[model samples]
Target: MTLSVRSRPSALAMVSALVLSLAACGGTTKESVRTQAPAPAASGAASASANPDAPIKEGLKLAFLPKQINNPYETIVDEAGIEAAKEFKAEAKEVGPSDASASSQVSYINTLAQQGQDAILIAANDPNAVCGPLRQARSKGIKVVAYDSDTSKDCRDIFINQASSEDVGRSQVRLLSELIGGEGEIAILSATANATNQNTWIEFMQDELKKPEHAKMKLVKIAYGDDDDQKSFQQTQGLLQAYPNLKGIISPTTVGVSAAARYISGSKYKGKVTLTGLGTPNQMRKFVKDGTVSKFALWNPKDLGYLASYAAAALVSGQISGGEGEKFTAGKLGERTIGAGGEIILGPPFTFDKSNIDEYDF
Candidate 1:
């Protein structure tokens, strides 16, 4: 069921029948009779009633708010979401702060709410800092969808997770262990300290390192780059200087990984220290070709945004109400089911290296 870039369009034909079949099911159809009472609204669940048969509303206004406007990875994700809006005849636009600070996005959230957007897709920089504004938006009947990064469970209707948090965290540790021969001092160059996604993944990496197989590996320090290029470059230098015996480094953010690679490429640590984490193919290609990096991993950013857009539309159209076991068609990505905690995982991440890096464009 893994999707490659070339195979996504072909899946539409295969899933079209499934969509029709689900719509025709007697008991599940919107027009069917029901004996059970409608479920009470959970803390973060959508308040709107479900209408599974309702067609996607046209000319709906959707707004995407990322952590910052300049991050290339977020740019790709937001662009894909905007494209998806076009497919369903919705008007979508991207807006956000220039800096990824804890409260930088507050003003934008307030503005989007005031503008009466039907839905707002956000990647929260700080989970709690934006909770108040998110609540205000939800009070206005705006559908809130968190993607890439997340807010607390009670703050959003749905979270479009790129992959399982546990899988992403543990995989980074395993990849680094294999590269550094299973033993030595290592460090994590992360994004902001309060970033929900980064902190969650780092916690899993720490838990994975406690296993007996990784006993020889020591995670000495975790330095925050705040997702800034110059800061990440400096932090990489600091990590190497602070732990001269460091064998590897893992940076789970795209900005941090690329910055770390640039620093390692021209420094003495290029061949001695191994670097691995989540990164886009195009951004890491030059480093991989020059032998500065051996391997890294990430899911398709375009698909992440595309799926998020559809999920938001489903919420607005009342196709589902952010409840567990609810299902909706994500256009070409096919039918997606909501899991516990209002989460929809895109899929497992794909690893990249010199062997197959050339095969991907983003």
Candidate 2:
């Protein structure tokens, strides 16, 4: 997580990257920033190709939805699915709102159901709020899978998690605890307070903090930035000003973590402070490159969405259901199942640093 992220302000690099990617992709930057409506029923635009060697069944119309459209994490995951679809011969298209909002996603969910999609995979905007509609979609024979963030278990047939939430939290706590030498003050710059995965990870971190070795890493403040870089940057500054001796910061939000790292890197506290959290490799690379951040964590979102799409396609093709013991192939991703508490881990998180940063472009 030793990523040397920067800011004139912070983490706008992601937005900059988005702008550049969209421009290269042949769309106006403004339109590309939002997850537009699904392209007129696939339009037969070579969206469904043949997969001679793939394990997928043909003629599937699958929908992939993250909390928001056009986001770096969502964009990568969507692109990965596009590549997988070319190989698997399934009809995969991503759709979601311009911003991460429960109301917006709820409306989009309604549209997907109306579109008669074979399966729908989602990173829900709100857990409890979206459950009812998801359950209703299921009653209509649409396969429902939760990707990055989840809807409640009862509302979802399966949760395609990027990594174990507990694992993510524990990784951060262990790394941060080590950075602080097991003792000192710390804080959390979380995403929206209600985000299920973030909340679960933070709860796990709280429980971990009770461990004897972590007794010195006093978690001083907890703040929310709504995943906005500006807000996160402001909160980071606030934390520094409010808690002058704050030893470290664990920002479980991708945006929050990067913002904190950027602030810590350029501020007078550069070497004296430590920061870590869930962040993208591309977003965190420069930060790590400069030693602004020691280490941070996140399951690869591209892989997360790739697997989620495959799982949804499997359900559409009748390969498997969320039965007590059912295994399915996510193509190159290997086999996975609904484990205890209905969990589905994509894989373990990779810790980013100098040695491997260059290998990853996103």
Candidate 3:
């Protein structure tokens, strides 16, 4: 039941004119090829200026605010930004609250503004809850780059997308459908309900499930784990009890998927219920080895951070204005053009299964 769908290579071709010169940076890997459905040509404010002649600013003071501090996934992703900063000779620091609540990130945004940080990168806890603070920082000339998740368009200079929302949503359902024979009672375990990225992906997943081929499958419930391990574990336990015949679960958040795996591996549900979603190899290795999960998907977290740092540097240096046709050089990752909607995609999400799990470390 692995659905064969078309990819959006045409969108990549549309931005070819915006790619600046590519250069080698120390140990940079060849830019991972990105394939995403092109958004409609920019409209409204997003289409205002096609600044193709912006300059690259260097030696900036940068800060990253993830959804939660000390999250394993965020830790690895933010470290990549730190490494990129070092490579580009910029001063970089990571800061955020331990909670993933809607307004938990506002205070960090205010602090970075007061500290006169040249650039700020954040994974918004809620799309609009922190927009006011972010807009206030923008008013102070501090460039903003939203990574992993995004805020309101006016609040940030650019969004560093790990993968297209459509692809991520469709892929998760496609994989889960295959594992469960395209027919069963399935549930979704997601991050915060207010998270823009999580909500978008879930919307597409629900849409994908409505296709005629998947008519036999019924989505039973959608649970929010708030991206916390303890809460996610408890939610999994609750789902199992509430829906005794649940055949599969899709935990699209890294924390949610890993926590669900941990709970299932030790319970009687192991091997009886299928689990699939986004997860790092290190976090999901044991579950995969013990047959708790078949396959899952994720783009490279390091590349996501690396690109976000570059986007921030470019914005601070006035190399780009977050315009549709803007272009900037992303270190060893090479040249990246700003696409419609102020998005700079990293690449497609890769699947990690038993056969290829050992090949990835982050």
Best by lDDT: 1
lDDT accuracy of residue 303 in candidate 1: 83
- lDDT by residue for model 2 (1-362), tens: 11233433233344323211110011111111212232211111222322223456676667777766756666777767656766678777778877665566887777777666677788777798887677667766777888778888777767777777777788789988888888888999987777788888889899999998787778888898767777889999999999989888888777788888888888898888888887887889889989988777665566666777777776656555555455677776676665654456776666666665565556
Q: What TM-score would candidate 3 get against the native? A: 0.86
User: Against the true structure, what is each candidate's TM-score?
Assistant: 0.89, 0.82, 0.86
lDDT of each: 0.84, 0.70, 0.80
What C-alpha lDDT, on a 0 to 100 scale, does residue 244 get in candidate 3?
Answer: 95
Segments of candidate 3 deviating more than 4 angstroms: 1-55
lDDT per residue for candidate 1 within 50-92, as digits (tens), equals: 7767889998788999999888889889899989998999988
Give the per-residue lDDT digits (tens) of candidate 3, residues 1-362: 01111344453342222211110001111123112222222232433334446655566788989999878888878888888888778888788899999999888887777777887899999989998887777776677899999887877878988888888899899999999999999999999999999999999999999999899999999999999999999999999999999999999999999999999999999989999999988899889999999898776677777888888887776677787767778887787888887887776677778876665566
Which stretches of model 1 miss by more than 4 angstroms? 1-48
Candidate with the greatest TM-score versus the true structure: 1
Question: Residue 108 in model 1: shift from native, Å?
Answer: 0.3
Please provide the root mean square deviation of candidate 3 (C-alpha atoms, Å).
Answer: 9.2
CA shift at 163, candidate 3, in angstroms? Answer: 0.2
